[model samples]
Target: MELALIRHGQTDWNLDERVQGRTDIPLNETGREQARTAAELIRADGADWDLILSSPLQRARETAEIIAEATAVPFGGVVDGLIEQNFGEGEGMVVAEFYDRWPNRDFPGGEHDDELGARGVRTLDEIVGAHPSGTRVLAVSHGSLIRGTIARLMRTPYKQVPRLDNTSISLFAHDEDWRVVTIGGVSVAEAIPTTV
Candidate 1:
């Protein structure tokens, strides 16, 4: 199985560097353009995607719809597990301020990092299991979820996973196990250290 993971387009919260975790923000005009660009890039890659899936959040769902229209691929509906991690008290706060106030990066009542990572893995497993052996799927999700998923798949520390840009693409392949191919268009061997 092969999968392409894409971060949803930018929202106003993203522009202001505010935490948008589970806030249900919509995409800005620029974000819609970014989604179109992502579709063009995928078309240029010459891969015929079987289908596209996305988180239930408006930003991600809209992005997936745009990509599906542009690529002529079917939209496979929302996967709840693809939802962004809840930031709890950190939602709507400027990212820098939130980190400054909570240096340890823990937000009160927020979802734990381990839980997010596990969810990421489980979601991918479910997707793969539901499809045929050679299925190629495109999934639109949040930055943190994508990062956590990649970290868990690579068996690397979450902090070591590089941040993903809005609409950035990462590819993964599965045989007996999952492995990262490229992240944000950079090859894993070039951009990530596989071992701790």
Candidate 2:
């Protein structure tokens, strides 16, 4: 089975560097354009997908819709479990603002990194197990969630994982074991290069 994972395009909140966990923010004009650019790239790849899964967040949903339309995949759907990590009281707060507000604070519900990774691992296991072998799936989600999933698959510490750029494409597949064929390649930024 081959799974293609993509992080949603930039939102206004993303550009502002806000902690958008569970905020359900919609895409801005540039974000929409990024999605279109992503669609064009995927179409050019000429690969067929059997399933498409997206996080329930509006930004992710919008990206998935564009992929489904461009790829003509009929099995596009939302999976709430794939939602971004809930930032609790940090939602919509800028990163600096969050640190300032809770200089010594802990995550709400007392959740730690391990707890979050466990949940992400379980969700990914279910997503992979539900589909048959050789099924090609496209999953649209948030950066942290995708990073956590990749960390779990690699059996590595979450902190050691590489950051996935907005609209970055990752390809994972199962041979003798699950493997990440590609990582952190061709992001939304690269789609429209600007000389600055």
Q: Which residue runs does candidate 2 get wrong by more than 4 Å? A: 99-106, 175-177, 186-196
Across residues 68-172, which tens digit of lDDT does each residue of candidate 2 receive? 887787646888777898778777789888768876435564334566667766766677788777788888988877776666776666656677778888877
Query: Best by lDDT, which number?
Result: 1
Error of 1 at 28 (Å): 0.3
Find the 10 residues in a row with the least total lDDT in model 1: 187-196
What is the overall TM-score of model 2 with all chains considered together?
0.84
* TM-score winner: 1
